[model samples]
Target: MCIIFFQFKPHSASAYRFILAANRDEYYSRPTKPADFWENDCNILSGYLVADFLTEEADGLTYLKKVSSEGHLYNGFNLITAEFNNTKGDTMCYYGNKSGQEPKTLEPGIYGLSNSLLETPWKKLVYGKKLFTDTVKQCNELSQESLVEELINMLNNEEFQLPAPDIEEQGQDFIRPMLKEISALFVRTSSYGTRTNTVILVDAKGHVTFTERTMLNPDANQWKVSSFQFELEI
Candidate 1:
C-alpha cells in the first residue's frame, strides 16, 4: 500500500498562503503504488484544499480539512495550499499540495511520514544515499526527540562515495549459475574536463534506483565520482 504524510505552516496572512512538504512510501510487493511515484514532492495534495473541506465522509478522494498537524507542511516546501481526503476510507487520508514542485532534487535528506496529526509514526524514506534502509530502521528505534536530532545530524554529514561494481565477461559457450553478484556500480561521464556522476543503487531483491552525485573535493580541478558505497539492509 502507499501512504503520504505531510506538514503545513502558514507563511503569510492570505487564505492560500501556506507551505507543503511530504514523503511517500510503497510496500516492496507493491512497488507501483502512490508513494513510490510521488516520492519527493511538496505539491501532492493541493487539489483537495481548494475544492472542499475534508471530513469523515470523504474517504476515497482528496480534500482539505482542518485538524492538528505535525510538521509545518505549509512552510516546509514553500507551498500555497494542500488537500486531504480518505478516498479509500481505511482511516488513512491522502494529502498533498496544489502547486507541484519536486523536492527530491533540491537537497539530500531524510523525510518523515506521519498521519494527519503528524504525531504518529508511519514509515520513513531516505534520499540521495545508499544507507536509506538502515537509516530508517535506526530512526524507528530511537526516542522521538533523539530521532529528530539524530536524523538532522545524519542528513548534515558530508556526502560520501559510491562504490564500483565488478564487471566480467563470460566465454561464448559457457553458462554459469556461478556468477558474482554486482556489489555496486558507479556510473560517471566526463566532458569538458568536468565529471558528472549518477549513483545506481541495487537492493537485495535486484531492484535498481538512482541517487544524486556528490563531488569529492571543492579544490579539485574538476569534479568526479570518488566511489560507490553499498550496504545490505539485513
Candidate 2:
C-alpha cells in the first residue's frame, strides 16, 4: 500500500505554501521508473503517465469528480487533487471509492492517506500525520535543503505500529501477517516493500521543488536520488 502526508497552507505568509511527502510501496521486483518530466508533456512531472484528460479549462477537482462518476471502472484508490492559483489561493479535494464518500473540497490543513481511505486512522497514518505536523511547525527554522532532508528521513521511518484490533478480528488468516508487516511507514518485506519516497515543496512565491529517492537494486540496497525545481507559470 502507498501512503501520503501533506499540508496545505496556500494563503500563508510563510516561506512555503504547500508541503507533501509520499511513499509508493510495491513489490521490489516490479518494473519501475524514477520521477521525471513526461516526454510527451514537459509541463508535467511524474513517474507515471500524466493524465491527458485533464484539460486546461477544468481544474483538478472537476476532473476528479468526473472520474468519481466512473469509479466502478477502476480498482479502489485514494485520489487527492489540488489546484494552486495565485489569485484564488489553492483548493484541494479527496475522493475514494472504497470509503463510498462523495468528492469534497478540503480546507487548509495537514492530512494523511493510505490504501484504505483519506484519514482512515490507520496507526501508520496517524503516526505519519503527527510527524508531518511536527515537521511543518519547524519549517521556518530549517533551510530548504534541511526541510527536504527531514521529510525524507520521516518517510524512512521503520517503526511498526501494532495492528488495530478490528483488523486483527476481521482479516483472514493469510492476510493478517501481511497487514502487520505493512504497518510501518517504511515497509520492508522479503519481496514487497517501499520502493520510492517523494517530497514536494511549493513555496509562497510559486517556486516548486520536487525530490525523489528510488530503490534501484533492492538486493544490493542501491538507490537513486533526483531533484527538480521550477517556478510555476502562474
Candidate 3:
C-alpha cells in the first residue's frame, strides 16, 4: 500500500503554494529505481515513469480526466493531478475509480489518500493529514530545509491505529491480517515495508523542490537520499 498527503494553496500569500509528502510501500525484494529525470524528456522527473500518450498542450487535470474515463481498463488507483501557475493561480483534481465518483477539482486545502480512496479516513491517512496540516501551519516560520525535514519526519512516523471495523470487515480472508500490520504510517515487516518517502514543495515564486529518500538495503538498514530543485516554467 502507498499513502499521500498534500496541501494546495494556490496564489496564497504564504511562501509555498503546494506541499506534498508520500510513502511508497512495497516488498523489500521488489526491483526499484531511484528518482531521476527521464533521458527522453529531461523536463520531467519521477521515481518511475509511465508512458502516457497525450498532446503536449494537455495539462495535468486534462490528462487525469482522460485516465479516469479509461479507469476500468486498469487496477484500482488514486490519482491526483495539479497545474500550478503563478499568473493564473493553480488547479488540483482527484480521481478514484473505485469510489465511482467523477473527477472533480479540489478546493485549496489539505487532503490525504491511501490505498482505499481519497480522504477515506483510513487510520494512517487521518494521522498523516493531521501531521501534514500541522506542518503546513508552521510553514511560514520554518526555512525550506526545516520544512523538508519536518515533512520527512512526518512520513517516518510509525504510530499505528487499528483499522475501523467496517474496513476490517471489507478485507478478504487473507488480507485481514495484513491490514493491521500496514495501519502504521511507516510499515515494516520481514519481507515487505515502506521502501521510499518523497517530499515536494512548490513555492509562490514557482520554485520547486523535490526530494526522495529510498531504502537501499533493507536488511542492513541502508538508505539513500536524492534531491532536485528547479523553477516551474508554467
lDDT of 2 at 185: 90
Residue pairs with backbone overlap in model 3: none
For model 1, the local distance difference test gives 0.25
**lDDT at residue 64 of model 2 (Cα atoms):** 72
| Order of candidate numbers by TM-score, starting with the best | 2, 3, 1
Query: Between candidates 1 and 2, which one is better according to TM-score?
Result: 2
lDDT of each: 0.25, 0.83, 0.82
Over 157-229, each residue of candidate 2 has an lDDT whose tens digit, in order, gives 9898886554455446744777777778988888888899999999988899999999986642888899999
Residues 1-234 of candidate 3: C-alpha lDDT, one tens digit per residue: 788999889887778889999999888988888888887888878765444622256666777788888999888887777887766669888788888878888998898987788888776678789988999899999999999999999998887777555456655674466766677888887788889999999998889999999999565288898999999887
Best by lDDT: 2
- Model 3: residue 121 alpha-carbon error in angstroms: 1.2
What ranking emerges by lDDT with the best candidate at the front? 2, 3, 1
Off by over 4 Å in 1: 1-57, 64-130, 157-234
RMSD of every candidate to native, in Å, equals: 18.6, 1.9, 2.0
Model 1 C-alpha lDDT per residue in residues 25-142, reported as the tens digit of each score: 1122222211111234432222123223322334222222332132235532221222221231111233333224221111112233322212223111122222333443453355
